[model samples]
Target: MTDTSEMDRRAELSEFLRNRRARLKPEQAGIQPFGGRRRVPGLRREELAYLAGMSVDYYIRLEQGKVRNVSEPILEALTRALSLSEDERAYLRNLVKPSHRRPVSRPKVLPGLLRLLDMAEGVPAYVVGHRADVLAWNGLASAVFTDFAALSPRDRNWARMIFLNRSVQAVFADWTSKGRDTVAYLRVQAASHPGDAELAALVGELSVKSDHFRTWWAAHHVRDHARGRKRFIHPLVGEMTLDFECLRPADGGDQTLVVYTAEAGAASERALRLLANWGADAATGAEAGEPEVGRL
Candidate 1:
């Protein structure tokens, strides 16, 4: 198989292992806990198989994606056996469908939009398509999290940053919720763009690299975060809780601009002002053209 196809397989295997392992509890499995013999927190493979009423061999094969044609009832059994969340159960079903896909296009980044993003200055602004691919982000956006322009193309994945990058992980103080939202957004995106090869690849890569990604992906949670409160710990800005908004075009169904800003008179707003001054000074030093600067 090619690299792209391999990514899909990897994602499938990765997510399966995570979900299967998350459902186990000695008490839940009706086993008496020997004071110190329980090394694993979740259920073992055989235990899970027994609960699902499937042969251990069959379950293992399914988990491995060696058996691809799983029925809905079987999936439901796995969901119940593993105690999967409603979102995860939905995700398991999505993974089996042929139409579910990711992006594979060379992104067409717009100069005007980049300029607008730059203009946002202190306020973080960036655009992502249906697949949650960061098409463009301003310097402040980069300052708050990533500098997309400076990063290698292969490494510009949002999910990877959440699960793989230390800096990104540190930004979200609410890790579990952060994880939930990430899956929710992607689940929604995957549904919106079922044939996007690039997105599929991103999902695939995450599934291969992180078991958490795998489990979450399988759960198939869906959400649209048009407006919400998000907290971030910027190395320069310190702790900040910003309100976020999603702007979508009337003509384009998938494109959205995400803007982050602190509420008026809030401590985070004050911190943002301080960070802005620092950012201006740094921008001056770089001889980089200035983007727009504004208050929250």
Candidate 2:
């Protein structure tokens, strides 16, 4: 009897492979099309098998997740044949052979890291650990993004905020793109942390809740968060464009300290300055147990 987890993993593998294969057209792969009514969008099973230099039966079984112990060479062949991105390739490997090690139960927020966020008070900064949990955040981050301190620990996840919180969605100028990226990152996290029941539950909950999440999750897109320019329409500060960087702290147990900065002398810089002052003032005036200004 196949375990439920294993069956779920196999189903994910099959869907991911099929989606990747379906996106590459025959012309894109330099293959000449010979003929009958094309049923699917992209390369057929036999064509992909030919490109990967494997027998059709073997490739079909692999797609069906029936072939266990897939070799390195075979995986490499599939990577090339599908032209998977580095992130996508990593995701594929994880799906084929998931990690068995348990993740840190609760990632600690080091005092030094919190101090660093305090020191850089002018810009918005936050630390996100596994599963996009906003483990630690500065005042400016709450001002620019959301008041993470108010949310329960589980609801502090960026994935949850972006998908479930309508107010958070309104802040991002490119919310659709943001949602897609969040879904893709979560897809990578899901494959990488197969042992994480909380992570799995988060995905399941979002899939049931968000329409966009369900559609994008099925697309199988994968990417790592890096430096990017993002536009935000803050309720207090109005619109501002900021360049953000995701920095992984050494020995911080996979915690990424994300900082957002605007180009000097720009309107965004001025807006950030005003936002920082407002955030500081809000913090000073808040009564004990009072909720912060940015609820979502």
Candidate 3:
């Protein structure tokens, strides 16, 4: 790596450790508070070092990103001391020892995958690539989310839409929660793709334009969009709740197939049906009859 990139990596790693440490309370870590006024919100460096069973100087060096080739046992100790979640632990691993990142290239959704999306008739389904790019979408997905087909290629990112698009912001019932999740997902992607200029530019743009994005990015949170429930206040269909599942391909690529489903006999199901009908009508009017798929 270039010196500049190495410095950037070290800085990121340091900030991540600091934020994680700052969120952990001394009491929560079973540390007894001592006699002075505590200046920080969370556990002090010495307390953390004590919990991790390491020397204060060694822990300080690790926290400062000065330690190289951090051992597995040391990492495990820190993981326990910080009480990191599964996703957070994975992110910690990436930061301390990031893998060799491949070149960034536009990911293409396979024709077979497009067909799979089409077959998911009653549900909203889409494919998202490494940078949260909307690589492909089924009709219901376009209806539930914004019309991915209508967006400019660059505007088809979930993070961009969540942070920058007013209509999208209004659609999610809990916009802030959704926004934070988007930010966390982006952080995870950044750790994996440190050399991706487009990804970095996207983060920089969102950080500039959205206060929520800026704050959440600085928090150093990391998450995987594996499965979750989302509430939507869609314009046409008043309100609905849906459960989403993110399925990754066996090859372990960044492409994820996300599908959203509503309860079988719930009001949300009815709303989805209405949205599907509306989407079909909209589809008929378009000169391009097929749903826009694999447009990366």
lDDT of each: 0.67, 0.82, 0.82
**lDDT string, candidate 2, 124-229, tens digits:** 8877777888877767888888777677777888999999999999999999989998998888888887778888888899999999999998888999878888
- The TM-score between candidate 2 and the true structure equals 0.90
Q: Identify the runs in model 1 with alpha carbons over 4 angstroms from their true place.
A: 1-104, 110-119, 281-296
Q: Residue 277 in model 2: shift from native, Å?
A: 1.6
**Which stretches of candidate 2 lie above 4 Å from their native place?**
110-112, 250-252, 281-296
Displacement of the residue 246 alpha carbon in candidate 3, Å = 0.2
Per-residue C-alpha lDDT of model 1 across residues 72-191, encoded as one tens digit per residue: 889888778777676556656656544443444645545455555556767877877666666666556666775555555456556767888777788886877887788788875664
TM-score-better candidate, 1 vs 3: 3
Instruction: Report model 1's TM-score to 2 decimal places.
Output: 0.60
User: What is candidate 2's CA lDDT for residue 49?
Assistant: 94
lDDT of candidate 3? 0.82
TM-scores of all candidate predictions against the true structure: 0.60, 0.90, 0.92
Candidate 1 displacement at residue 8 in angstroms: 11
